[model samples]
Target chain A: MPVRPLKTKVEFPKMLNSERIQVTGKRVQLMATCLCDAFYDDVAIATVQVLEYLGCEVVFPESQTCCGQPAFNGGDWDASRKVVRHTVKAFEGNDPVIVPSGSCAAMIFHGAQIEFEKEADKDSVAALGKRTWELADFIVNGLNKTTWEGKFESTIAFHRSCHTRGTKSSEASLQLLKSIPGISIVEFGEAEQCCGFGGTFSVSFPAISSSMGNLKLEHVRAKNPDLLVSADMSCMMHLAGLASHEGKPIKAKHVIQVLRDALKNIGLIK
Target chain B: MAHQLIDTFATRLRPETKAAVYDGSKKGHEKRTKLLFDNYAKPDDLRKLAGKIKQHVIENLDTYLPATEERLKENGINVHWASTAEAACNHVLEIMRARGAKRVVKAKTMVSEEIELEAFLNKHDIECLETDLGEFIVQLDHDKPSHIVKPIIHKSRREIAELFEKNGLGAYDDEPQVITRRAREFLRKKYLEGDVAITGANFVIAESGRIVLVTNEGNSRFCLAATSCHIAIVGIEKILPRDRDLALLLNLLGRSGTAQELTVYTEFISGAKASTQPDGPQAMHVIFVDNGRTDVLASDCKEILRCIRCGACLNVCPVYRQASGHAYRSVYPGPVGAVLSPLLLGKNFPQKADLPKASSLCGACNEVCPVDIPIPDLLLRLRAKAKQEGVPSPGTPPMGGWAVMASQPAAWKAALVAGKLINFMPTKLLPVPPLRAWEKTRDLPEWRGGAFRSWLKKHNS
Candidate 1:
């Protein structure tokens, strides 16, 4: 099979302002995942800017922090308990705790309930669990009645991380992409498979990790996409690292960045 | 000796080749597992059902196990309980001797691998032949299995052809059908000639004492039918309360393991064939092996018992995809194997301690698991247990560092400061050899000064 490396830079037309006026009276929250805090802070900023541009009140809770996924996944019950307790305290009163990353949101929204079911803090866990939402899921399912005019003229390939596709069952990323006025969304093969950057597993088993990333890289390359976008930065980092190592030309960006850029071109972010 | 087998196989296969095979196998396993979960139960309903079933099984194990044994015995099948792997191996050897069996043809059985049955039988001058195509390929190459369901997944078609040609049993043709036909011709004769056939049961129905074998190639059926005596070796946890439960389980098994509506063959045998049956084994035996299952059953980690051997968890696990199965050096591999293997073989099984750290705790395995063993949880528990037992882990620093950091806040802060300083340097210059594995593939995030608590303190003050 001939492997055509994706071109990172592609020209995009200025979005029309008329479409931006259509989206109004929506509420959203920006969930800045742990990786976004430590590494990809730009993605978090873009997420907030984009949500605000869509006429949604983007609530950024200063108390909101790591989603307790690391401790929960590591089986450290005490640590997980402390983290979830803090998270529940921070976001429980909100209508919807919107998260940019699907996996972290799923962990907070779905996995936390399971983790705290019979614990002493059961009521608090249940309270927060009821309000959690992946950004796309909240936009498509919860805010579906509100129409949004997204005018982005570019080819984008969407990569669905495993947790989002399997656990959360949120296809809103695709729905949101499809709703864009001028963007052509392409599907990558095996989009749901892990990019192999499994938090700690990537470090613990590097050869196997890279091997998995190689397969994902092949998929991303096959599309010859203008840009590869995903809900999670951890996967993007893994794919981008492999792409960089292989000297491939494909650029990876968070879906929120695309939304932010498009909104900017339409003068919606002003 | 088991470690040696794994090392030999791993060395011969090499890391890159093994990695490529692992990537393909992982993709295949993931596709099948997802299809299985989607088809069998409402995606939202699986976790609840899996949790309930596992909880019920663990709480009432003593009650259910005996009920299952009694039912099997009542249906004219001999049921033997083995407390350990050695005991299980001895029990089978005793049966083999009593049957006057000199040769055996076997279907795929992880229990046999758990107890190292083939080696034991071979030591006693009896020949044991693996009949499953993947298994037979691994057997002929004298290599350990790199996958649970597909034992020879590490081998390409060309490798199989080469191996077959070297054995002088077939022509060198790099075609799957040609290789499969050659293996069938070779194993068919052995199956008919063997005195006994041994296979693993997917689930042992507690109500009927029947052993259920699920297979894609129908080789299990041939293995059970062609010999004079048939043996179904299984873990005690394979018991289900009734036949009605089979519908749900079979649905999960087919989809989770191989992504089929049902396996090519689903055979439920309660006992040996009666005199009226012309082509079935005359004597049937079901050996229920406990090994360390009872130990796991007695502890907080009893949820590991609810595993159905579907290999769904393995398919979705990122670590298993990279390292493949042989790195585990056990009959079982992947998320399920990482937790269960150490328990079954005990802490003293050489290099058994390495199994616990083999996962990324991605939760993918838990998501795909039909029975919801909480695989990542068990893996962490095993790691703690291994640390407690003072089992030396391969690439980890001494626990003294962890002890100091965990108990003393000042020490922890100091260590964090040092770690932050180290993170500022290029990862290539980090001076930690153990961390090289990580740095080779990813750049360590540069640490900003100050801890979270410190940052909060400064902002509030």
Candidate 2:
């Protein structure tokens, strides 16, 4: 489906009027992340829809592949830096690079900086971090689009991706979800616990990984929410996989995917 | 060589242990968060300050180490330095032999555990009894401490009761009070009969030459009071610059470890009791055990020395919660041990190399650390160090192969196309072992490989 840009200029809350107001017209480079490119293409598509729906021009850098997190996290810095250099060359523009996964975005902003710490171009790499934003953070904080007219009806148990802990993206996703009318967030005990999807950790230590995933799934199941939502699809993938394996599958989505459906449901964007 | 981490983890797959670890650590983590936040307006600032104090001391061990020795000597405490665990254990034995003390009473000390002092002393036919209730139970059961702060966090009350009954402590009684009473009654007698007291210092102040011991039970104090000869096994990293630093460090320790404002007993031992004094130890020996701490300080992860043995990281760690402490297969467990154990192994880092990979890098351990050790960062650094050392990371994917695909767009695109074959491939015949591990508990999402790139092309057109 072709996503058309929203023309209506919805006024943001008066408190945020002094902030950047022209984010709607700003062009953003989409970092579709390796995971989404191969598996969850719909999440990337929905993310583009939501960004365009906020009147921002979304640019997909086709040359971009992975964020080098897998290699970086796996202790192969030489291999990780090679992939990281490729990413640096791919998204070489000055536009803000937006990522749907908080974990991937963190790889750029935090992980890449560490990988390139000793290099001469480290300052430029650090500059890249300043311009990268997780999708929900860009929409809510960057675009100042907190008060959404679109309504979403569902009970969501939001899994705060552990990668989002240091970044503002986790709070941004929750804020966006809460601002939308008709959506009730089902709060569970130990809501901030990780779903054991530490990229390679999911596979390397599968038994322990699944056990941790099962603990999270138990909490998510206790609330019996209609959906399990998170800002990072990697976490959602691990969790949904675990939930399904246990014979009770959960409907998990990225925050942008949910927001896209909410806007589409309200006839706000086509 | 394959690392022992996974092999050790395989041995600790008991359901009862996992359940106990999960419940115990979760409650500890929650309690720490609540207590720290409720008590301090800016707990992060407090944690940062605590970290700064420990970091400063660690960085200046050259200055503090001699100063501590000087002050401790001036205060009439015999100062002995041990460069290895064997040497540390031998020093204790030498001290005991000189004093002709066969019966030893002990306070909980992870450093002694690191040195395997009790077992060493046992081989010498020296009776060493654990005075702390948790240590008593752990000694009774001949089990390694699964946690730094709580020794038997892996054991349920039922198991403790069974162990107690089997050991002839009493009939089966799972009541918490009864268990404590049984241990207290049994241990109170041993304290008086014990000839030498051995304890671990939580912090040794360089300025005042005092060793600080924080315990919920007054067992350390009892051990000190009951014995004329006292021996303290102190890790060289436990030195603090000033006594004033204890205010903040102690606050962080109590709140972070067990959520108490202060432990029940906080004793500061200045020296052996003077000639005119009534009680306390007549002679005191402090063994400064290096045992690879100096090696750790000289390494890239020197900041791990800032650890206070709080076990806050273990409580917050998801891996530690599920696998329990035995999985790490080290004297220290959880995130702290993941970094320290391997480093402490010195030339044998490969033995515990997989400890670094055992973590999911969730960053909770980093967040919960009282001294603000960047645990995840340290874990990553250790992994890198292991790779550089050619330590085998069995079951881990070859990052070089993935990097080749990721760095070149054409190869990446071709790989994406190949990823579709995963959907058709039977689980029994999956090419990658990690993928087989992945498929054990989770179904893979059907491959929609290269669809996004095609859609982007179509949409832009």
Candidate 3:
């Protein structure tokens, strides 16, 4: 199936780095990661609602699929290049590409570039990388919505996915969440540690993965937050799935889902 | 096939050992973090400088290695070169035979373990004693060192007490001080009576022909004091361009390895002491062992040779914490071992090919690395190398099928629809081993694969 090109020569304002960032043009291309498409559609729905509420037009390119992270991380660059090439064609545009996953966004920005370094598509991937932003980063930095008006009367323990280390997405999630009124952000130990949702790593070493997850959950439980929130669903899936299997299911949601709920409670979105 | 490595990992998953490793490594990680941060206002900057220095030395080995050999030779130190582990071990045996050295007390040298020196020497009727307390315990138990710096990181005090009692060191006291005293007393006579001292060099100064040894127990100092002959087994990658490099690298090594400001004893030897001096060795032998390091240096992952043997990567690794270092089944373990062991295996790289796949690519190892080695990137490179060579990796699913499905939207959509059938099936019915392994502990979310596309299409219209 051929991927239709996105609108051509749409010159959006340059990404602002000033103290006061004004997002003059708010159109963004949504790369709903495969995890959201398959298992967590609500995250995509919430993402759209939250973006729309913040006065941004979100476009979903129909030909989009997985970001080839699974293959790229597993050391199969040949297969990764095949899928990543399709992605380059799928999201070809000047509009800022917003991703809900730090891992997938990093794949587009970093991993894909490494895979295509020797190919003619390297330049195209580099351009894509410049425009790719994780969702919260797009909202806070790209869209310039630092202060959230909606109220949320629940505590959350955020899991900063290990992939988010080299990106500002983790900080953006924290900034947006803390800006909301009535939201209590609880602190936990080993906040920098991984939750063990390392794509193929979870399955390749199940006992170790489960043990690491159990350790993370124990720390999360100690904080006793109402929700386990993160920008990446891959991590949430592993933590929430393990917790459920252990008969102590915790309410887990993507950061956007929580934002959507807050906006809904305040009558900002129907 | 998963090959022999995975079986080694699975078979060594003892619960108690895992716990010991977990506790010891976590404490090390926490302590290293605190010390490094407290000491340096910008620890990462220091790490980068150290990395650049090592990289400079590695890249210009043609200049520095020969310069090192000349300086040491000029200083009256006998310099020998060994390209393989057997040759390296044979040099030590030849030295022992020449001197008719019956008893040898050794310092903690991981490279010696790489060459399996003690076993080789014992097989040749020369008695070699491990003087470092943790290494001493490991040798007594006839076990391989689990961790690079802390050989007994996987052993509890109770286990050590039993091992010591069984070895007739003492009647079995678990107190830390008592254990140390018992081992110290037993090793005291051996150190004084030893005919030769064998140790590893942390770094060799090419400018002055000096070798540095750092130890907490001062056993290396004892070894040097007692024996008239000193044999320093040096890896070819251990050269520093000048003595000034030690100010940065030694600080990093201490803080990264055991969180010490400086190891209790940082002894630097510049050949044998002047003839007027009476206390030090009369002859010094430095053996530069390659043993596949040059093979690694030739590969794209040569940045790994910058490692200072800190063991910080092992402490920070989640897999090492859970599986323990013994699972790696090599002299080096954890992140550094994962990269080095396979390359060292040469044609047998296929034997330990699974080592690279053992990581989650968490990037923690890269971050904690004192010399700023890009360990995760190196691991990925090795993984790609293995695949390019047609090595079979059992646990990793073939990406050929995934590539086909992901590249075509129509096929991907079709797979999504078919994936929902998994919601109706039992978890036990999950066909793939990776999925089966995943479902063993975690529940799968209800499959709503294609819902987002449908919702987006309608909303857009």
Candidate 4:
């Protein structure tokens, strides 16, 4: 399948007009994660489109690379810090840093104790951690946008990403999806289980990871959803990879893309 | 060696996992989890209190244990200390030999299993009978208990019924009730005939020097009260400061392990008998088995000692629920075993270094832990130790590349190009186990024409 550019212009939420955008200055820095930058650009674009619809200026910093979770989770603290420092430097200028991927955002948010404790600006790094938000969480809670004007309906199997617990992004995404008209949730057996994409974990224990991923597959397979959706693209990719490998009909998307697709289905985006 | 061991374990993983995840859990954990939260108004506070009491007992064990020993001695109960597994087993053997006891009835105890007590005693021509239904079934089959709490959780009902029939326990149907009744009748005979009773203490009280036990079956009571002599094996860490703490620990234990309001029987064995007492065991011996528990209490992994053996961590753990207990390769399995095994057995245990890395660090175990043991945190600490111990972790090569690429944009962009190119080839042609494993269940990323960074450049320009 070919990748297409996300439609830039859309009818913005008129309710937000001048009153709401001014609250946070409508300024946000987007950390397009390495997974999105390399493999799933559509999720990144849809995230931007979703943000644009919410009336926010989304800045994609080119200097931003990987989130260092791979190194950080592997117990290589020095290398993790080196990568994290560059990321901390990349998203500068006081805008709320929005991450489309929960895994990456979680790495920076939760890993600050080990990532920044020794740094001269440890407090600053910790402050920056507070500013970071996973995209679904940013859209639902940070922006405080509840109802969707556009209608979308499908049986969605939502994979609650592991690291976004503090933000409650997984629950927020479910609530956000419910606002869209006609969408039915297919509750899978292990819907709350991790997608087995724990950065280096998927690689380190591949057989175990693969075994776990298959269990996740069986969970959703029983539900027979129209699509597999998750707040984290990292998990979506893992699930999609498994489904597509088996020639199963299921497709995977980030929760925002599911929303974006619903809008596209109704000709809301051009 | 570590990789091979894990690979070997992975092959046998599915059957046991299928048994637990599919054939098992018909009892419904969903309702159990709901009841646990509903029954306890402040679950977190309860967990904190349980953790606090355990930590207090562990930290002050030296002072408290001697006092407990004195109290038990005054109550006509003998207290024996076992520094090693061999010593613990020998102490029980000496007690049995002293009484000239030939037939022994046993209740479920993971520690006795740890000491290989059944096999040791049976090999010496003594008849050791397991009274617990699941333990009895496993004993008949001459198989190890797959789960600490459930014992034969991996066995199907049909298998249990078949095992019972094969053992000449009569033609009971596969109905759970029928099998349980048959086991009751069968074990009642052993209970009446046995000369000595051996049981595992759920908690050994310091203030009262008593053994507190909980079981669904009433056999534990028989194993204590029906016999002339009774023996209890307990870990040093099982000591609690007061008898009142049993209320808190038992609440967490039953809810977390089996999701019960309370077990069928919560029996206490403190003193042997009064001078004019007509009932209860004439002699009571409580064996305090250290067996590396003190080492666990001394180390940074001390919090794991607070485990009341609830198996809640096992029930919620995605890894445990899928991989099952045998995959863990321990008497104790699941999240608890993953942390406790390496800590208690030392780093030299088979595949000890790889055990911690088996988890995805999803934090499920820590979330559901009754005592609030930071299981995932301990796993990470063990992973660090494993890395330092010269065991090659699968995390190294990819993370090394990820770190280097993430440090510089030029390197990252270059890697992006390489990743795009790599995604085009078949997964087998690609040279990594992670990708190979990824391709087994999930799709490799389909590289679009250009990277999102370049596409962003085009849009912005």
TM-scores, in order shown? 0.79, 0.93, 0.93, 0.86
Give per-residue CA lDDT, model 4, range B1-461, as digits (tens).
12424434665665645565434432434545787779877787787668777766666777878888887887789999999899998998899899999888999988898888988898878899999888988889998776667778778777878888888877857999898888888788778888888888889877787779899988888876568898888888887767888899888888877878889999987777667877777998999999988888766677788788877777767666656677777888878888888777864743666677777878777677777776876776676566556676644454556677788988777777777656556767766766655555566777752456666777668
lDDT of 3 by residue, A184-266 (tens): 99999877678988888777666667878899999999999999999899999999989999889989999999899888888
Ranking by lDDT: 3, 2, 4, 1
TM-score for predicted model 4 compared with the true structure: 0.86
Model 1 native-contact share:
0.18
- The list of candidate 2 runs beyond 4 A from truth reads A1-25, B1-12, B425-430
Give per-residue CA lDDT, model 2, range B387-456, as digits (tens).
8888878767889888988988998899889888888879677567777778788988888889988887
Order candidates by TM-score, high to low.
3, 2, 4, 1
Clashes of 2: 0
Candidate 3, residues B213-243, lDDT tens digits: the string is 9999999989988798999999999988778
After superposition, the stretches of candidate 3 with alpha carbons farther than 4 Å from their true spots are A1-25, B1-12, B427-430
What DockQ does each listed candidate score? 0.12, 0.30, 0.32, 0.24
Which ten contiguous residues of candidate 1 chain B have the minimum total lDDT?
B1-10
Compose the digit string of candidate 1's lDDT tens values, residues B1-461: 01222223444566556766666666777678567556645753664465555556556667778788788778888888888878888878999999888998899988898889999889999999998888888899999887777777677777788999999877799888888888888888887888998998998877777888888888888887678888888888887766877877787777777777788999988889877787888888888888888887776567778888777776666666656676677788878888877777654643676676666555577777777666765776676566657665444433333433333435544554576655556656766664565556554444542344344345336
The local distance difference test score of each candidate is 0.69, 0.85, 0.85, 0.75
Candidate 4 positional error at B263, Å: 0.6
